[model samples]
Target: MDVDTRHWIGGRRVANADTFEDVSPLDGEVIAVVSRGGTAEVDAAVAAAKDAFVGWSRTSPAERAELLRRVAAGIEARIEDLAQVETRDNGSLLRSHRRGVMPRVAMNIRFFADHLSSLVHSDFDTRGHRNHVTWDPAGVTAIVTPWNAPLMLATWRIGPALAAGNTVVAKPPEWAPLTASLFADIAHEAGLPAGVFNVVQGLGNEAGAPLVAHPDVRRICFTGSVPTSIKVGESAARNVTPVSFELGGKSPLLVFDDADLDLAVDLAVEQFDNSGQVCLAAVRMLVQDGIYDEFRARFLERAATLVQGDSRDEGVDLGPLVSKSHFERVDGFVKRAVAGGAEVILGGGPNDELNVATGGFYYRPTVFEGVDRTMEITCQEVFGPVLTLQGFSTEDDGIAMANDTDYGLAATIVTGSQERAERVASAVRAGTVWVNCFFVRDLSAPFGGSGRSGIGREGGTWSFDFYCDVKNSVFAPKGWN
Candidate 1:
């Protein structure tokens, strides 16, 4: 398909004077020439959103829900096309994008639409005075989504922000902007009003900075790294604009002696599903002393079975990293880990043996043993197909080790005993804890992290709250009046 790589502003594709090549990581080929927008483009998008907010914020909930449903239908109809674009742009496996990510994008839109009615205002009486609480749209919201899982994360922010009657100025990562632009097309086809949704395509320093620092933007929602989020937060702080961050993670997966060994091993291997590019992946595995040896053997056996090849190839379990730089960064982590006294037990470098038409950015699924909690390998967010295994003596020791990191995005407890599961789940400092499962998400559940992982939450009512402002009104009694 011939894609018009341009910025989507005010319901139209706008071209910038300068452009950059959208390189496909799969084969290191230039896929498209994307417009390189800057502060001017961001200003235009924000102005458009502000102008549309007057009408959009006044629309009734039912009307907004209808438009969202239409958007969801449009996405569902073009899932295959979007999946292909995403696979090419982000280096994700075509099968995973088609069967996993694209469906969630559609589901996110529909889920927020169906749950709109639940964002209710409260009425109560306090000392014979009637009090009512209400919600209002928080002006123009600037949503900056990351390259990994581009469309899905974009929809995660857009669905709730739009459902709450807010206008949006979105900045999709420069590396993977095609699917996001396609999503804007789908929204326009679904009858989204001009400027209600706008996308500014450019590098973060040029376009994203202006959007976050814009005085007209009331809320800033960002999904990316911790260091970047700190800068975003500082920029928004100058204007006192509310900002929501879904940052990185060094999340842990704890396996107790009594756990379902097979299930634990399966989840441990599945951590490399998206080439370990997932923010919520279980990169740190903390196993109990009694079963650590056995678990390590089983996990290695499973990890060795992963098929690393071209994303478009069928039965390929792992795809290339997002870019050459990322591939190198992951490799550097492995080298450093080994130098730091960690043992590389399995595949630890790029896979060059795959038969492909052209050169691609590929890495083998790497596993490290004898990883201490304080080691850089165990503490840092590798953001690759690198897993670090550590052993713990007791349940308390396991929980302590799990919460030792600076990140608290997610964690999982695998065990047969419900009491043990609950105990560990409650003790872990992470935001979302999985019991006997991993990456099993529900739209209604609150998702986000504590401490350095992020601030605030996304999903369901929490999302609605973040995207809106609450105001309360009180009525006086007749005698008092």
Candidate 2:
């Protein structure tokens, strides 16, 4: 927890006039103070990246793969420290962070290292003539990553963008910029060239906006809320720069009568894993009418038993919501749900275990019954440890309730029969559907949304296609020419 007001530009850290403090969501503690960058630092980062793009983009794919391999090694070596920092900064549970954060980030790095060269060198031939398609990096990329899953999300964008030969100006959330600073040092050890990858620290209006709006930036990859995605999309449009966004979700989880009650309950907690901050967290639970009461009983039993406390506490399964503002926002939604006639089935209070004088954004993992599809809690994205429960009498009704919301980022259908699982999974409108399991993701599987959830996809080996353009090269016989 150090306060250093500087940014990585042209391969090294540089100072800025203004500063911002990074506060720990666990205890509302000032963990670090990062310097805010203005037009000068953003321009410098862009210029440096443009300068580096020439050689970096021209480097062989094998060489790029080797660099990515080293970056993976550096991250592996410091996995413990990185996981702890992510938990502290994002208020994710320590155990979950360790399990979910490290392995995934390393896997992304390794996945790209192993497959990027092949993806880049892959060629296509059509009609007995040579027609080739190559993947090239977009020249200067502005990566605007969210505070949630800082390192991992950055790797998702930066890894592929860099692997394809783009130089980058990565801007992490201003609330947790220090981790990206740490990551930059890790990259330095990984042998990335000066300006090949840079981290600029500042707020969206100052640093993020300029970076996105910069004329030299050819592409953008962002992960955050929908409103911000719209802004980034607008900037990209004005500049004619292609952009990718991994945005918000009001995902659903369906439980059928045949599902194992124990398993369904466990997955219910997983839906709120990280206190339900994940973009694709299963915020809505749709249970078949036959088992609605039983499912509710089991869900409340498990949810009531969960331990919510400081990230530093042992056996703490859930931590605080990000900050006071986030806490207020989530709490406000819960209040609205209650006012709208949803019954609080379980857990509706603040945790008193942590420092109470200055409450860290802590709230009980809440569940609501009597939820109608039209209610705000059921229809909107309540990015908190809050789950709204709705009962459906038939299979079609279950699907109808699951797809009721405008957001369709992800959903889960639990059933003992494969036919039923597939049937419901097909009917549910979402980018990802978990069959009998919830929140389980494969790095090689496509991840995105179906509706207002998001615009672009991430994850999977072939995900680079969403971020790059494809062109066909044709050859004719010399005699014909």
**TM-score of each model, paired residue for residue:** 0.98, 0.95
Error of 2 at 240 (Å): 1.6
Writing each residue's lDDT as its tens digit, candidate 1 over 1-481 gives 7666888888899998998888888888999888988989999999999999999999999999999999999999998999899999989999988898999999999999999988886689999899987778989999999988999999998999999999999998988889988989899999999999999988899989989999999999999999999999999999999989999999899999999999999889888978999999989899999999999888898888888887888889898898888889999999998899989999888877652545788888998987786688888889999998889999999999888989999998899999998888999999899899888899999999898989998888889888989778898877652
- The per-residue C-alpha lDDT of model 1 at residue 352 equals 72
Q: Give Cα distance to truth, residue 254, candidate 2, Å.
A: 0.7
Best by lDDT: 1
Q: Name the runs in model 1 displaced over 4 angstroms.
A: 355-357, 479-481
Clashing pairs in 2: 5-35
Model 2 clashes, total count: 1
* TM-score of candidate 2 relative to the true fold: 0.95
